[model samples]
Target: MASLSVPINPLPPPVNRRPDVKPEISLTAKERDEEKRRQKVNRKIASQKATSMKLRSEATKAVIGDKSGPSNSKEPLPLLENLRAHIAALRWESALNVFDQLHEQLWYRPDSDIYIKLIVVLGKCKQPEKAHSLFQAMISEGCGVNRESYTALLSAYSRNGLFDKAFSLLEEMKNSLDCKPDVHTYSILIKSCVQVSAFDKVDSLLSVMASQGIKPNTVTYSTLIDAYGKTRKFAKMEATLGEMLREGQCEHDVWTMNSTLRAFGSSGQIETMEKYYDKFQCAGIQPTIETFNILLDSYGKAGSYEKLCAVMEYMQKYYFSWTLVTYNIVLEAFGRAGNLKQMELLFRSMRSDRIKPNCVTLCSLVRAYGKARKAEKILGVLHFIENANVMLDIVFFNCLVDAYGKVGCFVEMKGVLEMMERKGCKPDGITYRTMIKAYKKGGMNSHAKELKGSFASVQKSSPGLERQNLQHSVSRFDSNPAS
Candidate 1:
């Protein structure tokens, strides 16, 4: 077979060619070395940046007590505890500051529960503006905007007397999907409404709850009972109680019993109170220390010394440790009865039992001494006050002024104003009224007139003083054993 002549052309010689490639590929040796140096520098810069970020994160964790690790199973415990501690202490600014630091953490996640808790704390601390800000931040951070979070913000507004805002939020919740107002939400709002004596609002909230097929829980019924009792709307309170009992699902608890007993007892309905107390006990609700305290306070106020003594004896036999309220009640009872020897004995016993006398205790003593025209005994109380570490409030100072006035110690009576000023408690209407009355009684018409003029000036300077004074006086009276 004849082989065909193959004319295969030789390939071109291998050429040192870079076919329009990237600059680095076409670099000369020096250019290549320079490119390598530039790459190393870029890598070093990146490493330094990563290190700096890590160091900054570590520093932040150290400062804010956020000792988080790679495991993301739980939140940073130290950080949470620090924030909770501040919140519990009512340190609003500190709590928010810690919260901000928590947000900047690498492991931080926007949590609705945490936001809700802070909102609640701010509400209790009367910082509704801060609570709303936190709520907005929660939404921005993609946290779930559910009923609980909304209710928390609503509570913040309502508890602080921002009812208009609270109602608006309620309406918003009603219109929102999956965030409708529930029993707890209505209960919270109702409680706040009751606190501010907005009974009409409370009724409306209750109606809404009923319409929404949300049955009132024990807390709701108890709150209504307590509020009605406080306002002396006995018929309404009784009706509410009846409704609660009619609702088979909502069982009465110790709190309900306490409210009922307090209502009757405080109004001097001893027989009714005793009967209900027995009924509550029969219903398997055990009385607590608060129950007995209420009894003692009621009997003491009614001047039923025998019953008060019986209650005290019963508490002792049952090994119920006496609280400060108990001591104050008993001390005030004995003092009002002019049993100075017994009052003094109880005072000594209170101190022996490591119960430091508070403003209420001292006020009782001063009042008793003043009533007995024993100026020297009042001075002794003053000496004790000076030695002891009791925080005195405006109420206590007012009592001191009245005591000095009763004993015709005009100079000391006048000095109380200065003391109140030093303590940063401005004089309210009751303060001026008390001094004026004292001056009138002491045959100092000029002094009384001067105080009247000052009172006018204060009223002008602070328009809300009268209303606040009335509230303060009512609160003081409610707290007083004599009431």
Candidate 2:
């Protein structure tokens, strides 16, 4: 009965609220105020973060050469695609320009992988400073700093022969908590050292790797073997191969086989090269087109025409397609053998096969024609070059000069410098040396002396030119040596 008598409004009327209820209402208001305050604080924090990121990006852009604001026209994907295309084309400056454009896009996000790719491209283009700049920009953009990023930057420096910077960076990587050096890091450094023929440094790096319990991989052994073979360090090369074979984890690949073949083939050790080729075959490493090219090149250089022809026949028998390098190699071989008629036929055949001739191909024609004293043929090559979209480098220009000089085309020989200037290729010490030697051969002592004075000035300014010229004189005396 008492429960049924409970009032509908037991507490209070509208103006007679209890004190406890007043406290409850106050608590709800406090919670509302706290939520609003919390929201305001969050907004302030987000604003500060956005401003900091914007400022950091601005600073990074200032360092990276583009100060423009975000572009609204191009979408992010297209911009990124363009950047990748330029990089793949080996156009370093163009790639950087596209990267700048990408940075100016509103939807752009910093990507460590893209930065690493750009850095690698710059390294290949011999633009270590630019690569370093991009690496710094990657860090400033708040991109994740990891082993890959450090290795890429290290590779850039190493590729450019900046060993000091490379070593310092390696030390830095060692000190990094998140980016300790790995086998790939040591392998890359070893390859760089091998490239410069700095065997001492390579040994030091290997010892360091061993001390750190990092074993050599296939790439590392291959690099060492290739370098040693190229440098005629047979003992070291064989030792490296032996060590690689002993490592159960490092199975021999096609590259390894090619390196071995190339080492012996390039050194004119045909017997040894053939032996290794057979061994590799027995080891189940199938030969690639590069393998055939290496064998052909070696045999061609050593005047083993029969062997070269044998390799060619084998390739044809196997239905293997001829690459541009294959065409260049055979052309050079025939050219060197004074078989111009066959060389011309092959050249025509190469074009019919839609393999456009490159600088190396043109160089081969010029050198062969020059040796045979066919000035007209050299002229024909020049005409072909004018029509073709082949990219000419300093080596090609040197060959052109030699060809002209060989055929007593003094005027044309001198004109190559103008061609070089137009092509935006600076003449190296080899270029000057070739020209000077040609002038002296032509009995133009006065001109030779003048060029000699200029060369002296160049050497004085560069300090390294004389050494480079000496090496060129001793080792790379031919206009169109094997590629």
Candidate 3:
């Protein structure tokens, strides 16, 4: 179309020109390389930190063992075992340390159940302050609080005989609806008060519970009856039991009967024990294994071997499975009756029944053998235990020493002491007293003096343990047992 003067001017670069532009201040090659190195260093440091934290988290969780997790899970086995072992051994110090480690974990979250358990363990170990610290930690961690946890901490304080602190905590719980004191709480407090013979405090606590409209349950009444019976306050014991039978929230159970019988049995009131036993039986409360053991113990201690034999016959006729405790009671009864043959026979039967003998059973055997002038049998028992890989506790060693001493085997008795040292078992006060008595009887003044010196050293080394030893003297098994 013709001769149009088409002046298409040369195109200018696009307006943005991003591809052509360079930064105002560009990095030199050296600067760029330095920046790359810095980034690499930072990444390496961060990776190391991440690994460190991961290891710490694993270690912390390992201590706790995540007991709430499935029991069959294998990953937390060792930690779970550690927890159980420490708690079973009543190693409160180790347990608290483990608890602290658990809290320091990276993935750790507060848990009420864990705190409740720890608090209870601390109460058992009589470490009230540590328990209170755990409660404080639970609060600071923003965990849910409940009456059970409060009751646990209260128990700790009560066990330690910090009555004021316990009451203060109880009052504190009263003010907090979420952590209000229940029958268990008052029961624990009442038990503690009764333990220390603080009857006034007990009365006041009962009054407070009534005012608070918290009714006493079976446990509360059982604890009261047991405590009162222990103190020989038969009137109070009978009254509490009567109240429980009449108007208490819970019915009388085997435990109350046991407590009643124990009180009478411990005081050599076998007739009263039997009467109460019959009454309880008529109340539709079935006898437990513990019941039979208690009866056997009372009869044995009262020198009513005929009654003990009758009870054994009844148990056999009823096909009641003999527990480790039952075997121990029978062995002790036979031992006290000076029927060494029967005791040894029962010992064999105990093993055949697959019920492993504990220290109490072994002690009964030792005392029996000692009485029969068959001290050699004790050596046999030691050998048997070694062959069976049964753990040798200090009590067993003490029993060994006592048996040898009673037989006038001073050399063997001292050898037991040496064995104890080699086995890392510490000789307690009972051990020292036993050896000293034997030494004096043997007219070995120098040996007795030497033992006295060592005994003093042990006392110095473990001052707190002396009180615990005294408490354990009244062991769950009869204190004046066969051994």
Candidate 4:
């Protein structure tokens, strides 16, 4: 009886608490309008950034470098690395096929890490739905779900401009303590907002982060600086830079420096760019090839050809191997400066240097030759293109069409179109638009009108080529700021 008289250990009081969830805020009409204004300006800048970075990435691969090829030291599985390489190359189809092959291998086992990796790859390819499906596969495989997996899916949504879906997922994450959005998650979401030109939402996001006591890290500040700098909000950009410097743990890195330089450099503020470039260098951020490329572009555009040549010489003196982007930039600089002889010489030097020419290289050459009205030179380029075994792209063909059309060589121009078809390169809107202009210039009004009729579909394909039709043929390089 005494043993049964043990003190009753009462159970602790029931633990009960409501989860912390952020209120879903909506933007007012005024805020929306403000974003629209910023959107227009930011999109112009963002599009240029996107185009430049895309070609630059391609250029890096051309030069045996890779900006996005797994920088981590922990080597992944061999098949997984192949998948990553395909992803880095933007070979989405190949990546998917490789992944499929991996799944079928005898050694293959259900792995959440592999699922997340593939999901991230598809996200960058702008295939959010496909990534979403992969997420489902992860769940079905009994691999379980966590914040990282959800964040990867969120990234996919955000990357594809699926803001509503991303936010909804963010809400779901908020409801789940195991998968709440952390600083890295918010940084990605913020960058996504900036990409979509949702500048208005940025302040709200930062406010939420502050409320959450989540101090922004280097990546967060850099993203904001880049977004603001791209929108010409130098005060905001500099303010962000100041904040980053003020943070004891955070400092200016190559990314922040590069973004700031691009904002100033692309906007033709070479002086400001140089000022910041030197400042960043003093801060101990060594320049990369991208740095040299930006220098070349700024100097070239500012008519500081001497400085441009100096940068090239410095690269050579430092034994910096020139990338395809570097060659393209130099070639374009010479072309734009009307140094046709220099352009021609550089092209020959590139060939002799055994640097493989891509569509961009040929496009630059075609443009320079076209500007000089040397149709014969374009013919030589076409011959070189053939020997180089470069796949003919629509841009190359369109440039060819414009080159001949510029010289009133309608026969050759039409023949270029035929060559394009034979090479399985379909003519884009620019192709037809260039032809329409040439036809009008030749006083063939009916022919121009007929081609204009076909433009309905082409315009559907390229909604941004809204420029007015003119006698001057639209070369592919026309929109390339670097060119």
Candidate 5:
């Protein structure tokens, strides 16, 4: 201590020492608190803006009604826009109401698109008169009508069995409107003529189309072929196909080939159908499902299991994916051939392939099982139908009831009837007749009498009930004249 003091020469007055000084921050507590509050407010404002932008985007999309891409254009005026939306949604009456409002409020400008849309809607709604009136109004307004407008009207009339109206429209399209009858227009008119079995008109239409330089497309050829086939005029069908080939304008497409095959099949001309099947491929046209279905159906109807199997094998080899109709055709073939084992195997295979059997398939199987007197198997099919939620139509229900009744399983038949009623499906005359037949076979005369009465009542209530009742009654009377 004494040595240190000797080196310090009169130490300066004790320097005032202070603790380490911290940097002086600029913000005060009040300013920091204010800054935090401002930040929170800015975040809230940004969030609100983002939400508003999202809402606007959704609203814009709703207005534009496009499947893809952004809708930039503002929606059309409210009345017209609403009317269009209603039409798009198929709310025909509502759309008509809007149209009426539009006519009253806005100036009545004959917009071709609107008129077309209205006509289509009315036609779909089965308001043919309204559709016709709209068409007349459009013409009166001097609106330019296109092919679609005339075609739509013609189709409506055709569907309703108004052949005269359909023909008149066709003539007007050609004569008054000066719209050349294209293949489509001609096809519609031809189809209508065929529906009415007006073979003469179909021939005339085809000739007219040919003379006008309007080369018939695949549809035209298929329609004419179908018409000729319906009337069992195979010679005409052949001549038509020959003409198509000779014209150099039309080729033998799959549809034309299929139509010819169907005609042959329907006429039980299995040999001819097979010949054409070979020729179809030789003509450099690929066979389609329609071709296979026609051949298979023909073979099935003829109970030719060998031919059906051959066709199915060919289908598999060609990698043609089997459809419900394909399976149904084979099922029917096996059924009619009394090849129950093969039919069952095919039905099981259908399920294994994840192909759900439709009403047609089930009906075929039920009919087959009934014919084989396999009541249990038919019940199993009914359960499958239920499990798959497959809706049973009149034909399906009739088949099931008949199958159960054939085996004298009154309980199961009644169960099916009750289930059908629960599902709001009214049994047709065939169903009642089948039930009566089963009751009679089982010697349950009381039930048979009741069912017969019900059948008569149903027929009386609904006129023109497809004549299934009359056919069934005749068969019953033929079998048991005493009844």
Candidate 6:
């Protein structure tokens, strides 16, 4: 028994058990290199995708019609696309650089499509002179100009108030290109003539269009009506409408009817406007936003706020949303009528509807506040103007200063002047005149004298100003210190 126990004890010396350990993993050199390569490839793919997206965005901005780059350049289409995009995006200098990169054959090669697109882009960028030059270059290159091209050029000139050039181009189209005036051409010319009050020229153009067998479309009638309305020639507008009706050519188009209604509304002929509305319905025509706007503006101008509200209600019922111009019209009417409460309510309604108040709206509010003698409210309006970044023209600033000065807030007036100066706006004659009047009223004789002297100095520096009248004003100020 003792021997057996001794043997068993000797057999079991030590049997130590420990927790299992995981083996460390390590990549081979080749594996590590391959992994790095994969990462680089992924990065390159991402970079390429980003670049493609950028190019697409740029190309969209350029409004490129075709995918093919200029035929001569072997470079990537993206490069040319980017250039065109820059031009469309209004990066004129960058666009020029792109054009420089294009093949010489593409440069100044009159692509009517390209020319028309560029003309529209440049006009939007307010580079009308450059746009005109491009048009001339197109013609010089013997590129056949299309009606669309001529129309774009004419529109650019008209928009920039270059009516002389616009008319010259029209004549060139008729004489050199033998391009008969289309309905759109006549409409553009008629609208331009209306704007410049060239009624006789508008009539002559219409006559020419008729001779060319170009029927006076609805737009033609609308243009003539707008022109007559602008000149307050109600009789002419009515007579024109009558002629259209008698000729059996009176299609009761919304635009045509609106134009007539607008003319009547603008002239404050409420009865005539109503008559047109009845006639429009009788002719089975639906009134558009323009029609409602015309009626609203007319009612507003005539100080018939009740009628204005009724029209606004009609607009809502008809699902016609109000535009900024609509609000502006109503606000201006209320301001003129000295209805401050109504103005405030309208402003609140506009804000509630998320309609951004423009400079005109703020100006109208300020005017209403001034009429009500609510100095605090006027200051609030000024604050809104500044906060909203609505540009305050000289007239607006002058009005504010006058309003504040009238309320004996000389400090506020000076503050506004300082703000204008800080914004890089120089005080004009109107500004100085307003300041002088304020100082004189405030009995700050020395300040008024200083302002008068400064005005005189400016006039002296710029001899074109009529300084004699200002000198007389200064003498009056000197003689009457209390004034």
lDDT of 5: 0.78
Candidate 1 matches the true fold with a TM-score of 0.78
Which run of 10 residues does model 1 get worst, by summed lDDT? 66-75
Local accuracy of candidate 4 as per-residue lDDT tens digits, 274-389? 99998898989999888888788878877889999999999999998888888898998898777899998888888888889888888888888888888888888888777778
Q: Residue 223: error of model 5 in Å?
A: 1.1
- Using Cα atoms with residue i matched to residue i, what is each candidate's TM-score against the true structure? 0.78, 0.67, 0.70, 0.71, 0.71, 0.67
Off by over 4 Å in 1: 1-75, 411-429, 444-474, 480-483
Q: Candidate 6 at residue 385, lDDT? A: 70
Model 4 misplaced regions, further than 4 Å: 1-111, 125-144, 442-483
Model 4 weakest 10-residue run by lDDT = 65-74
Taking the tens digit of each residue's C-alpha lDDT, what string does model 2 give over 1-483? 455678886876758864464333445888999989999999999999999999999987554443233343465556777888998999999998888878776556899999999999999999999899999999999998899989999999998999999999999999889999999999998998887889999999999999989999988988888889888899988898988988999998999998888888877899999988998899899998889999899999999999889999999999999989899999999999999998999899899999998877888899999999998888888888888878987768888898888888999899999989999976778788888998998899999999989888877898875576456554544422333
Candidate with best TM-score: 1
RMSD list, candidates in order: 20.8, 19.0, 20.0, 29.1, 14.5, 14.9
Q: After superposition, how far is residue 11 of candidate 1 from its true place, in Å?
A: 99
lDDT of 5 by residue, 223-285 (tens): 888778868888888887777777676666777787788888878888888788788788898
Better of 1 and 2 by lDDT: 1
How far off is residue 127 in model 4, in Å? 4.5
Worst 10 residues of 3 by lDDT: 474-483
Leading candidate by lDDT: 1
After TM-score superposition, what is the CA distance of residue 356 in candidate 6 from its true location, in Å?
2.1
Q: Candidates 2 and 4: which is better by lDDT?
A: 2
Q: Local error of candidate 3 at 327, Å? A: 0.7
TM-score of 5: 0.71
- List candidate 2 stretches off by more than 4 Å: 1-74, 90-111, 118-144, 373-483
Sorted by lDDT (best first), the order is 1, 2, 3, 4, 5, 6
Q: Candidate 4's C-alpha lDDT?
A: 0.82
On lDDT, who's better, 4 or 5?
4
173-292, model 3: which lDDT tens digit per residue?
989968788888888889889888999999998998889788899989999998898889999998988888897458888888888988888789998888888889898988888888
User: CA lDDT of 343 in candidate 4?
Assistant: 93
CA lDDT of each prediction against the hidden true structure: 0.88, 0.87, 0.82, 0.82, 0.78, 0.75
